[model samples]
Target: MIRNTDLYTIAQSGLRASNTLLDTTGHNIANVNTEGYVRERTTFVTQLYGGVGRGTTERVINTFAQNQLRRDITEVGEHEIYSQRTSTVDNLFASEANSISKALSRFYASIQTATDEPTNMAARQLVLGEANSLVGQVGTMSEFLKTKEEELNLELESTINRANSLIESIAKLNDKIRVLEANNSYEEPGALKNERDKAIRDLAEIMSIETRQSGNDDGITMVNLTSGESLVLEDGTFNLFGLNGNPDIQYKNLELRSTGKPTSLRLAEVDVGGKMGGLFRYRSEVLDPARRELGQIALSMAAAMNEQNRLGMDYDQQLGSNIFQLPTVSGLNYAANSSLALTANARVSEDGARDLTSADYQVTIDAVTPGAPPTLDVTVALLNPDGSPVTDTAGTPITQTYTGLTAQAGTFEKVLGGIEIEFPDGAGYAVGDQFLFQPTKDAAADLEVQMTRPEDIALASPFRVDASINNFGDAELVSTTVTNTVVDNTAPFDPDTSAFDGAGGIQGPGVAPGGLVGAPASVVFTSATSYEVRDSANNVIVTVAGATDLNNLLQQAKGAPGYPAAWTALNDYPGYDFSLQGVPKAGDTFNISYNTDGLNDNRNGLELANLQNKDVVLSSNNGTTSRFSFQEKYANIVSDIGEKAAVADISLKAAEAMKDQSKNWFESVSGVSLDEEAANLVRYQQTYAASARVLTTAQTLFDTILGAVR
Candidate 1:
């Protein structure tokens, strides 16, 4: 038979379990609003003698829900940062009235006014004033972007400090939790683990992170930053963090190292995330690119306008000077010293003068083998606006590699992007040395109107051309003028068709023109509809095969009556134009020669004014593409930024939805409910009361038996 003592012990055990259950429920209710707190549940195990009886109660928790929640939170954080930064840039560029578009229109309108009244002092003054305003506007925007970059740098530093602080705090908590867990004191150390987890979640808000729990149950949690770089190890050691570069001109990068390591590694090598990651994205994708594109427009306008100005004579009959001055190209060295020298120059390509992109290039001296026979390799990589390497459609990096560089240093020509990189042979390049080329990065800031006097504005052509006076036929030269020599090599010239591909060639893509730019030419008529354009040496530059009328013949050079034919510019030779008022007989020849009139010729200014519609900007791939105007390029930039901002906003909304859903799932599994906690309180109270009654009954029975024995 079971002893009365055993019965008393069972009742006492039941009472204690009920009391503990009540306490656990109350604790959950108390911390329902606490962040990162998981609801704790009391579980009872039955101890059997002859019958079942209540034994001990323990606390239980679900780790899976907590891990999922952390991951969702990290994704939400990344999207938020990206969305906010892009929105700022989008707003900055979206305005049309006060933005670059408006400024360009005003400046061009002023130029038109000056073109209409070439001798008007007031119109000329307005042109100079508008040019100054345009440059000022560019400078203001550039400075604003620079200011934004500095602000991001400050934010980055603060974020780094916060990340480091959380890392250290978690490591300290790890030490405490490990000691307590080792001693099997789960009750007190559970709170410490909660604190550490909160720290992890906070750190995740600033960057992407991955965590794992140790199998040994020593309370160790490992954390890895972007792309599997160790942040906090399982043994409780966290990596140290540092920064490199000034951040203002970019190249500011995160550095990381283990506690025991002497050197730090670049964070860019790893996939970085969080607030710091967003800053990097903003700097490279928005800030740096805006500045570069601005500079590219400034450079294109200044270079082309000034070159055309130089081709004309000033009002006083003197040669024209630059209207706007800036560097031909912009370049920077990774490490600058007195011994280091470099030149990165860019010019309009002969093909079409298509506009170059704002993208930068990296030149690196890599893979050096030093010995009796030293060998070095040079590699160049084209970078996207975000500072990431550009790739082909198949995702391979678009890189050019040159081997067997025996010369110490020389100009590297034949490189794409219409640029030449020159290095001084003295203090030759070292292995691993890198140079960055930002061809138009500083153009806006460096632009200035070099001309001071109104009389200095080149409004007249420096050279003139006239038809041969000895032509013997009904053919008579009607008019002559210079045309812009920049021709599109890809544009087909067909006399039968009214339309012409100004930059495209009839043969195929990128075909070189046969005519020489600025060279004199002679037009010899084989018949009324046929003529051959010859250079000074009598070599045929292009032959006009079929022409129905004078207008058709002038517009298109056809191979046959209906077939489209390629025609080179008679002189890419915009110095002059020859015209025939009447039909010309066969064997009648017209000689086109440069004009000696420099003072009273406004032909060059008129040609320069026509450049507003000419495609003179070079692109990344289109060498002779002349489609986009300077204003059009700025318009494209505005559109692209707006689209990116919209995409970022959409992504942010989606991420937020995912985060909310994850939190809801976690709450369903582990969140404390007030209604449930209240029900548990009442149930446990009743259990305690019932257990007391059982103990009293057993005691009463024992007392009665003792009295009977007495």
Candidate 2:
């Protein structure tokens, strides 16, 4: 069975196998430093029984190791994005020296200076300059954030395109590999497989993917989204994914689309684990919320300042105008399916902007019922970090549905986030139409200093108090005396001293039924033992039961008997308290009324300065009702961003460590080793030499046998 020819065949097979092994070793040595390159190993299989052994039949690739490495690559991508973006946000608010904090402090300091020197032109000018600086810086920061958002949008588009390109390349490679290995022919296409794996790794940087090996001899690998959507099919067909929205739209309003159909691929939709996921997270968690919080600050500050300034008087003795102008709400109506149009506008409610939240909301028209006044059944849902509907502790969606809304257009009838939304009456939205309301989103960018001249600043109190010129006792107005409402009545109890005309009657422009306004109610002594507080109509608004002097009578005026509960309940209830410098006679009378000296008064300026330390911002989500001063809320924003950055930095480090560990393990099993390859090179070279010698011997022996037979 062992002929000389057979020996020659066996020797030839050995030589061929040795050459293949030598070639494989050289390849390994050449590509030792290549990234994502797996070493090739020549696998030899026996030929038909009793025949020469077959040369290298295939190249062995470690699928498990490559898969593990891909996952680690994805982790690295995600952490890299998180660390970079969060750090950018943190650095923006890190310094208190020259940032928003410093600007705000300077602005308020200028106001305090103006209050100290109420009529100083230079001081008022300084306050106006500081106000301009403050608004300018806030606008700059908001614009910067808006620019970053645009950059992210462009980057997202490019990333999607890159992913699509890689997917197409991988699918093409699959076709080539499948055809090459369809019959288990000569060997697997090692170069093509390498290229495909590299493409897969590149795609992993953009978004997480799931893969499966299919087809004959594991030649065709199928890829899919983590949600089980077919990304690359066995038959070479693939699905393309994209984001649905123009660059102008905000991220929350954007949607992920697959093959022209809307799909959920937002950061919080599922466990997205790559660069794309990190970008979405940054938009929803860091960038958007920061902008909203900044807007909230601008809105609350502008509204409060304007309201207070309006209640005072400017240098011209005119009622104060708004110092800063801003839209109370921001509404974006989604394009509807039907021709029916919809419009919405939001305005600050009487409760103020401090109670507003930093989250965006969705308003959905559930139904429209016809009636004398048509009703709209609308549902509002808070968006999650990924733009999904937020859920409660019990896993139920947190939603509010308003039914029987009959208000017409031009009036904001729906209230949420301390703002009201107004809709067109007959132009109501169709079912399923949606609107996204961002109450504080653009507040900062829209904030502007409306007061152009220093003289426009309201530094004086609107109301003034005077004593009757005919009074017997020495009673004067206290500097601490403050009032929001005063009577405009022309009648006066003592026409010689009171500014108001209706000094004894409550009826006047500012006075209403059951209200304390117009002329200050007179405290008349019914007896030397007791006095009664009477209105303009001589109605006893308050009566004291105990005997008392004028000082005791005024002190008792704060509570019932001296001040009626009904008058106290009136809007902007006005009251007066006085101290007699000397004893009062039985017929002594004094006037407590409006002041026309508001033209040069600085009392309101002092009050405005006091607002710097007051709690004017509302806290959200916590069950306990709490508030924050301007600086305190700003500090919270800074701290929140810093914490997020720190956490991201730590996570990146941990992920890097994990990735390094995974890489080491993968390299140990799949990476090319130069020393090992060199040793194999020597062994295969010797085997080749030995096999050549054997072949030579077989030839020589065959020649000898032939010669002998001849």
Candidate 3:
């Protein structure tokens, strides 16, 4: 059992095992700085009962740690991109020079000064200057947002290209790896396999991916996008493509298709995560909303100012014209039918401006047949910044349905949210026809001052009251004022411009249809509280029945006959409501007409300046609608971006820390450490020396036996 020859053979096996350990140690030391190189170790086994067997070399790796590292890497990648982009916008709004708030404040201050000096041309010029400055600021911010969106598009294109390259590289590696595994090339993972792992990690930096082994022992990796699609299978690779534009053509859309195939799949931005996710996320969450908010501010402000200026008489005496041309936006058609002639648009009225939010909308033609128009109904839904359907408070989709709208080409139908989803009644629409409307998207750039001359600014009301010396009655027209502008029309519509501007002034409040221009309207009190309003022709236009109080009488007069059901008057379908005080004898008469010489009257200017504090900017709070002043709205925009940036910053820190921790655990198991390798080298060298000594002793004993036998 203990023969010298047997001992020599066992010693020889020990020496071989120690030599393999030394070689593995040296290999590890040599690759200590190599990326993804797993440490190698020599494992020895015994043969039968006594002698040592050949050594097996295998890589040191932990599957859990590698997966954890991959997850952390993906998270860090997304946060890094999102944080940087969000901070850019946050910093822009935080600056005083770039902020819309400062310019807006200065703009309103100029108007405040003009109201005090109603006839001053210098004050009016200052107002125009401030308006230009404010417009410039809005344009600058909008341009910045557009630039950011363009930059994101470029980034997406680059990301897709790089991802495709990595995918191809991984597929190639898979092909080589499967070949090697098939031939039993190595006892453990070889350099090619490690290189493939590193390539996959790089891919993970762009998108969320999950890796798994082949179930049938293919030895090739299968990568899942984690967004519910297989990115790479054991046998095939998929490539990502960026469509040049989406429905609006403002940015790119991502798609996926197999290599060498025409069939493709569209990827939703919301469903994706990683660096690509970060870029789209910042665009949707920060830049888009910020741009929309800026446009809304510009649009709403312009509408309000234009409305008030139109209600006043300019120093030129001709009815004040539009001070600023209303911002016009035509809806974009999508998924169009070649024969569908229907189109859509939006308009915000002076009053409706307060109801406008920066949300995007879609008008869909349901029941659309190839040759017949959709007359049954249309679906309108508010969209998120990412073009996703906005949900209601109960989480159900908030879709506004309008029925019985005609499908007639060239005809217009009104829909919710001031949207004119007009189409003819009976013309067929193409299948999947729809329209996209962004009410304020273009306002910042499209807004223009329609007036250049300071004399064009309106600072006087068109109506005034006087104490009639012709009336022997003791009633006096004490301190009369114009509460709101008048609109005298059967079907009043302000789709774009002010309905009451220009020729609209020819029919002042209480003026009959086609009445003489600038004629005084009369109100003769039948009783102390009961008065019948009449025009120059003495046509009874408004009648009060039982009025104990002037304010109460005004409310009761809202049900006045001869008015249409869809009236848009300032007070209960009336152009303006009157507030009369004191006791007046029956048959007392007072007249109301244009304040042509009202140069000293700044009442309209006061009202216009007061618009600065009006609740005209629409906002949402907990699913309820609330209106904010321009300042509050602008401040909200700045704060929202700031909050998102802070969140992105925090997310980055968390993601990086997690990645570092996971990397530490992974490196401990598979990564080669120079110090550890050096120690192993020394240990293996000593073991080899001891093993050689054993071999030498075995040789001596065998030689002794051989000499003895001789």
Candidate 4:
């Protein structure tokens, strides 16, 4: 016969296990939408088997899949964060580049207008106005870039703070989980695990990380990220935290709480690869390089333009003066040294004067030997400034050979007017006097110069003049006729008489009194003979004439056929085409000087243009103009984000599919469908009713037996 007690024990144990399974299913359904919540399952085992024991129900949950899901979730979080950051920065660059392009267009338009009306005041003013706007735009754009960098800094700080908080929370969970698992708690503490997983996901956004479960403790876990360093220990404490300060992301180093000192972390040294790794790589390499390149462009443009502006220019017939205003940029001052030489060719005058057109001259200055005489070579050019060969008024090409050439060391002083050439040791000069050089019999000349000076020729006063007049003539004195034999005090006209002689004939005062002479009524004089002044070496000395005032002379000289053009050429000229081809290594310095007149006179604009082209290179530095195009950079950022988003979406979808598969599989093994649960409920109810009926029968039999015994 079946024992009633054994049946009760079996039914009760089955009921308890079923109830637990039902609770677990309800928990999973309720928290389905919760982030980081992994579906849970109850674990059960058959009770101790007794004699004639029937089989009991049991269920077991899969924890390995839950752990893998946690890791994937962290990766998804990190990828999202990095994608957002790069996208933000890329957008900023796109905006800035577009603004720069607009400014460039406006500048070009102004230039076109200037070209149309070169001499129009309104046109010139418009050009200047547009230039001002362009410069302002550059400055504003630079400021905006700096502002964006500041924003990044703030974002970094916040990220670090949030990471630290998450890490602390994670450590706390670690401790709680270790204790709960050890105690074999009926409650799996699934909520705490979910929170911990969320924290790990948050941390992954800042840095790529890896997790390892501790072999010593079921709940203990270790976190390893970039730089091959342990971020968290198995002992439920964080070993690593980020420093909060400026957003020098490139120099980001983790600080160990135990040491309280920052440790260098090189992503390159670590194999940890993820979205956080991508962000670190971008921060350290791409973004930083872009910023540096922009700074270099700004500094080079500013310095070069400023140097050119300082050269000054003449406008509206005025003397040379600064043409452009330059802004001072901190930490970008350039120490410049330049050497220049001035030379001129002789040309003939139409008035039968000595022609300077054929006389070729050379001038040289060396910076290394400032006071030393420069090497000079002279050559005559057959052509004029108009690129046509020189011809006399007779339509025949006239040529002349220079004679009595001489050269000596001279002190060249640059004054406001121009460069003043002085004799060496001040020997060939007189107080308040001047000297000049004239060419032979031609009207056109060519001059060449070799400069060795380290500094630019400082132009001071332009011209000098001296004027004095003297007269030579015969003279006679007359007195009224006095018959009285009185001594006539009037001097008499005598060409051969001495003033001190007392002869009876009238004596002329020595060469007229006070060295003065009166004009004769009518007299024929011979033509004045031309005389030439020569230096020690018999070279004819020439004097520059016209414009007695220095300032006027400078103004007139500025745009003159030869001298002015030469001066303008030097104003902003970039000296010789020097090459670094011969330079072997760093710390090597070379000295070179060339005629600036051969180059552009306005160097500021040229330098600015050169900077735009990335032509100016610092010593030991190479500059690159290859920048990420708007479309390219933006596309890269967008593509990266889209890829990660897609991957995350796909991963979540796959996880969902897997969960469904696991649910179906689990249902086949242990899950209770509505139909099956209902059937089991009915079967259990019937069994309970049958047991009650059996008990009633037994009671009736016992009562009958007891009555018979009574």
Give the alpha carbon lDDT tens digit for every residue of 71-178 in model 4.
Answer: 454455444444555555555555655354566456546545544443444644664566566556655545554555565555655665776677778888889888
- Can you give the lDDT of residue 210 in candidate 1? 84
Which residue window of length 10 is worst by lDDT in model 1?
Answer: 498-507
Minimal lDDT window, size 10, model 2: 491-500
In Å, residue 93's CA in model 1 sits off its true spot by: 0.9
Per-residue lDDT value at 360 in model 1? 75
lDDT of 1 by residue, 52-117 (tens): 344332334556766777777777777688779888878888866448878878877877777677
Q: Who wins the lDDT comparison?
A: 3
Estimate TM-scores for all models.
0.77, 0.83, 0.87, 0.48
TM-score of 2: 0.83
lDDT of 3 by residue, 1-710 (tens): 44444776777787787778888888888888897788887787788756677776778889899999998998998899999999999999999889788888898888889889988999999999988888888888888888888888878888988888888888888888787777773465567878888889998888888998988776688888887677777766656555545458885667787666877887887457789888877877788888888888888888878877866777776555677776656777674445435555565654456656788888776664334444646788887666767665677666788776766655566665544555543645543667778877767877888889988788777666664666655555434444345454433343232224345243443332322321225677788777776655676656665577655333455466643233323332234434556677777777655566778777777777888899888776446677889988999988888999998999999999999999999999998878887887788788778878888998899799999999
**Which of the two candidates, 1 or 3, achieves a greater TM-score against the reference?**
3
Off by over 4 Å in 1: 1-5, 49-64, 185-188, 245-249, 267-270, 328-331, 335-355, 364-381, 385-388, 391-416, 419-432, 467-601, 619-627, 698-710
What's the candidate order when arranged by decreasing lDDT? Answer: 3, 2, 1, 4
Question: Which scores greater on lDDT, model 1 or model 3?
Answer: 3
lDDT of each: 0.65, 0.68, 0.73, 0.38
Q: How many steric overlaps are in each model, in order?
A: 21, 12, 9, 35
- Cα deviation in Å at residue 617, candidate 3? 1.0
The Cα error of candidate 2 at residue 437, in Å, is 2.0
**Native-referenced Cα lDDT, model 2:** 0.68
